[model samples]
Target chain A: MNRLFTSLAVIILLTQTWIALRLPKGFYQDSFLLPVLLIALLAAAYLMSRLTQLADRGKFWQRPCQLAVPALFGLMILLVWEAIVRGYDVPLVLMPEPSRVLVTLSNNLPLLWADFQQTYLKAVLAGYLMGCGLGFVTAKLVVRSPFLQKGLLPLGNFMASIPIIGIAPIMVMWFGFDWQSKAAVVVVMTFFPMLINTVAGLRSVDPLHADLMHTYAAGKGQIFFKNQLPQAMPFIFNALKLNSTLALIGAIVAEFFGTPIVGMGFRISAQVGRMNMDMVWATIFVAALAGSLSYGALALLERRVTFWHPSVRREH
Target chain B: MKPQLKSLTQTQGFAVLTLVLGILVIWYIAALLMNGNQMINMLERTGQSWTYTQVLQGAYSIQRPPLPVPHQVAMELYQSVLNQAVTSRRSLVYHSMITLESTLLGFALGSLLGILIAVGIVHNRTLDASLMPWVIASQTVPILAIAPIVVVVLGSMNLTGVLPKAMISMYLSFFPVVIGMVKGLRSSDKLHSELMMTYNASRQQFFWKLRWFSAQPYLFASLKIAISAALVGAIVAELPTGAQGGLGARLLSGSYYGQTVQIWAALVMSALLGWALITLVGMAERLVLRRRGLTR
Candidate 1:
């Protein structure tokens, strides 16, 4: 089975190489050819599977086959996307091919890097920290004062329901068309999630634990730190995880309103106006990379911090 | 226990009192700072301003920002609706209707597509393996980046009108529904499936009787999110096309003319529209869930 799988991979690569060689120079230059080639590749794969005597070792090949299917599907999509645009002679202004997008990224690396620094490094990071910190503090305050819990929770809900687009322009007006405005939007976007999650987390401590702490004559601060805070870590981390994505999105979209010619959102909107689809795609690629990495890092932190939680324990 | 209950009630009462007092104090201070005479004078001054910049600066100088004071906006809004010719030029109500037409159309199309894709994913293992990841990756390419390309491509095809804008909304709104519906459909427990199996139910019956019913809450939650997303998508769609009608167009024009009041009024209207849409869905959810005895 292993041998058969190896042969199949070899055949697929060789076929692709042969097809690449047979095509006219700059065949990939035309996006439409890519889709046609992809379809042919899929057909070849089907036929290869039929000819190969791999049926007896089906279970053995299942895991590799499972992995291969998604990879092939992704490759096929890119191929078709490449082909259709090329063959149809679709204007580059409409949809640039993935290869062209890559070229644009490399060619304009410095500008992209600068936009990244302005938006992600300044606005997103600053706003995320402040919002999450304030939310945490407020949650603690509200826990201590039932009056606050009653007054604030509904207000937060109302605030959360206000769409980012609605407040973003207003924020731009208030904070000016700079990173400050974007950060303000991010702060608004991140605050509610953190507040709600932290409140829930603090409340998540078992009454029995609280009772024990009370019996031990622990002070309010001691009880909170020793019992409630530890219990709420998982929920707090969940909010943080959510806020990471929200902050990135908030920063990017906020830049769309009125920005000073730099930032991911500015580049995206500006480039689209210039009919530079490739650069728009490139900016998106960087944004996606940043969002995913931040999310992944937060997830890692959650795992580390909440290692004592049952959910983490079960995974191990 | 009585003391505990009394304390709880007092605390709640205190909280409510504080909130009310806070609001009253803010309002009172604001009113005192911008006395009625000053407000009238500012309004009178703003009315005399001709250039866009002057009007904007006048509006900005006011305590509450007079660009579009409540009454001015109300008058404009009334005029837009009543004076149909206003829409032909750049009326907010007229553009809102144009945008709404596209938003509703896009939302319907996107919801249908999401359900179909979800159904395919739920039923077919190969498709589930191959398509789900790509669907996720598709969102990685931001809609803002993609909207213009879609507009240009569709425009070149001579497909002008609300459909192109609606298509953009669909692209933006469908992902959430697909993800939500997929999660909802899979929420049926093993015991429930086994019970259906014991009843000799076919695959279709099993799905209809169990999975579909279980997915309603998730579908509703997703619909709330999707509908707002559709509105946003419709607005963003207008940005690229430079379309002359819709709320997006109104916003764009408002920005160009420095009609800060007009922009604020339009924004408030959109927010109200969003709230209304969400509320409508929530009402439907309540009615449906109530019928099913699922409301807690």
Candidate 2:
């Protein structure tokens, strides 16, 4: 039955794509055909969903199905998106098709790479390191004093709630119109989350384990290193993963305020003004790729560093 | 007197006050140092000899200082919020209202949509398998990067003002709520489910009487997150259009003209607004929980 649903989904998807391609240009625009096409798209989505459900029934196809379900879902959506825009003859400025975006992406590789370097390598990397490092240090300092923790925790939570990115202009004014300002914004944006997470993590050490370490005549440093730090690993990595995305966003949005000629945010805003939707989308594609890649890399590192942790161990 | 002083030191409010005072002192010194360089340069360019006290005095009031002193910022904030007419473009209150309108509207829509989607996902196996992954993946994309396109596209369709900005806010604020609500709705345990089954409870009855009540804490927690996300989204949306009626525009105009005080004032206002919004959500949570008899 699962195999049957899988074949049925594939058949529908292929048929839809082929029919969409074979149709005359703008055939569905302002016609009854548009509704029919939409219904077909819905049908395709429904079939794909059914196939996913069937695949979840057994372990026989678990690995392949796990990868296939999302891939097929994404492909179906993209195909329908392409068909709709082309069929409707939508203006390129309003929404460019995926094929056009890919073409523009390939053509603008040098420009995109420079933007990536300016935004990611120069600003995001420096700021992420400094911010996370400072946060960890602050958390460490706060962890030892109950009075300080009580005061700082609420303060840190409040700072986290503030729209920290609103400081981008002030940062630009202070640091000048370059990657440095962007880096400053990223630092501020990423700092409080890291501090809050690390504080929580460090305080999460098991009392029993701490007492055992005390029984063995363990010093403060020794207890922290052997027991508390290991317990804090998962929380630290959680903050790291969250900061990766936040750092990228901070750098990009800061660029929107003021920047040198190159950066992902600059490209996006600049292209939009020119009514160049494809270039805008291409930059977005790079950003999405960078974001997902960094997130994936951190997840891998977390699994490696916290292998003894239950969440990671449970998969085995 | 000694006992009173000792008791004051033990309180959390006292600690926070001490920390904030410490921060202010550091900020003052840092501001003096940063602004002093440019102040000395200007004085030197004019060939006027300056003393340390003179430079320190100048640093606190220097226009467009590299770092505006806290008092300077507070003064600007005070003037902008009170001195100007509330409807005037120069008024921070006007800009804040424009931004707040969208933030509140988008937050409402996003929460509704998110709750609906969570309900659908919980009841359907296929949606759980396919849509859940996409929902998570959607956040991994820098959705803010598309703010410009959304604004421009919607503008072309003659949808202007609050709706476009609100849509961006909705996109962002929905994610946390969906994730939270799905986890909340599924949080019912074996004993409860067995009891519901014994009662021959319908799906709606099980959901309303059991799952809904159980999900309250998670929903409120996520609501706090969602409101803040909505505020950020509204501000970012204002950026791309370079719109004239929001706090984002105030920041942009300040940057353009080198008005550091204005930028700082806007920043402070937005921070206050965020605190207020979160506090409101927290209050609502308390009220709801108390009504449900879950809290005393």
Which candidate tops DockQ?
A: 2
User: Model 2 fnat?
Assistant: 0.42
Model 2, range A179-282, lDDT digits (tens) per residue?
99988998988898789778877977877998999899998889989998999887788678768877888888888778989999899878877989899888
lDDT of 1 by residue, A151-199 (tens): 8765554455455765677678767998999999989878977887789
lDDT of 1 by residue, B36-134 (tens): 445556657777535445434444245434233455556667666666675476566677788788888998998899999999888766666667666
> What are the lDDT scores of the predictions, listed in order?
0.73, 0.82
lDDT of 2 by residue, B48-141 (tens): 9999999978988888998888898999998999999999998999999999999999999999999998998888766766676676566655
Candidate 2 residue spans exceeding 4 A from truth: A1-8, A22-24, A30-32, A200-238, A299-316, B47-49, B119-125, B140-144, B181-218, B286-296
lDDT of 1: 0.73
* DockQ of the candidate models in sequence: 0.26, 0.43
- Give the C-alpha lDDT of model 2: 0.82
Interface RMSD of each: 5.2, 2.9
